[model samples]
Target: MNAFRTTRWSLIAAARDSPSRAQAALDQLCQAYRPPVLAFIRHSGYGNDAEDLTQAFFLRFIERGWYAEADPQRGSFRALMLTALRRFLSDQYERAGALKRGGRTVESGSLLEVIASDGQSPEDAFMRAWMGTVLEHAMQRLEEEWSSAGKLDQFRQLAPLLLERAEGDELRAIAVANGLRTNTLAVQTHRMRQRLRQLVRLELLQTVGSPEALERELAELRGALDEMT
Candidate 1:
């Protein structure tokens, strides 16, 4: 069937599985969601410890049967994940003096590290963490849609545009370089924006049970973005 339809079904199937199946589903979901979560953690002041903490959180989440407590009727997955991360951070901070550092550090690191090392505040770090999570969720859904539709390469080609803001001249230059007319590039940009919005909505839907939840999430995302600026 269609990729969009498949994504919808996959989400439902994943949510309704038996224990073993649920674990598999959660694994896939985590794979899709982990990068942004890691970025968020790193931005939230965890630094080199982010990856290890993120992994530990997931391990404990599963071992503690956390997924079984997921209440789709109450909140979006993003919110729940953020809440989990917040609790993890609080606990880690309280035990910071006692906890021994372990695990391989992320070599390439995240954008948050660059921002923090530049002397950004903890509030900035918090907002960046949220922004990274939202962006990651949006990108993951977009990638999944593209992969399912067999247009993964096309999406990859447009990845830069997806990640950053584009000026009109810059977009025109890219269009010309790619052998496309400016008007065509404009349309493509519009489509990309729409897809991004849709991806965000799809993610919100997974955590939220209704349109109102999506609205709330969009507002939160916007607020976080504003904080970064």
Candidate 2:
């Protein structure tokens, strides 16, 4: 199958044609991106209302069929989601009084309306949270792979180095504790890191439309992680 057809955004784009598949895609999307959404909402100062706002955002995104407007040629799935979220937040801000009074009001608006861009973008805290979620999901997959291969303990032992956070002394101690030579531990760490990169790439690929977009998203992910550290 063509790569684009397998993307979550592609399933979302098929909302009008395949409601069941599109519904499944929406479920997966909400599950994976909920953390980022909550982070963004809280960072935007929603605080205690973040959970409600996040739920409302996804509800509108699904019931309103906003995903159908996603344009692959414009950017990656992350960008598409962020744009919609910005619009939704802007709409909410316009109705702050109702929201502050503990009332939920999601107004209908055309996705085509030009949302003014400012320094506060989805690329701010949202991008950082999204990248963290991506890395976490990739690591979870790596852990699953290692567990299935009966190397779960090894993976857990060497993961600090794989994440580039292990000190040489710490790694050496772990190697000695595991009854392995430091050189063998080093080799295992290198292989695990390479496998992790591959898993991260696969995770990004499923949400991106093209190779170029994948590269761009990967670069952004790296930059976001750097900012977080």
- Quick one: best TM-score, which candidate? 2
How would you encode candidate 1's per-residue C-alpha lDDT over 60-141 as one tens digit per residue? 6555555566665576666666677777667766555343344434344421344446565544554565556656878977
Please report, in order, the local distance difference test score of every candidate based on alpha carbons: 0.65, 0.76
Off by over 4 Å in 2: 14-16, 20-23, 97-122, 223-229
Worst 10 residues of 1 by lDDT: 1-10
* Model 2: pairs clashing at backbone N, Cα or C within 3 Å: none
Shift of residue 119 alpha carbon in model 2, Å = 13
Backbone clash count for every predicted candidate, in the order shown: 4, 0
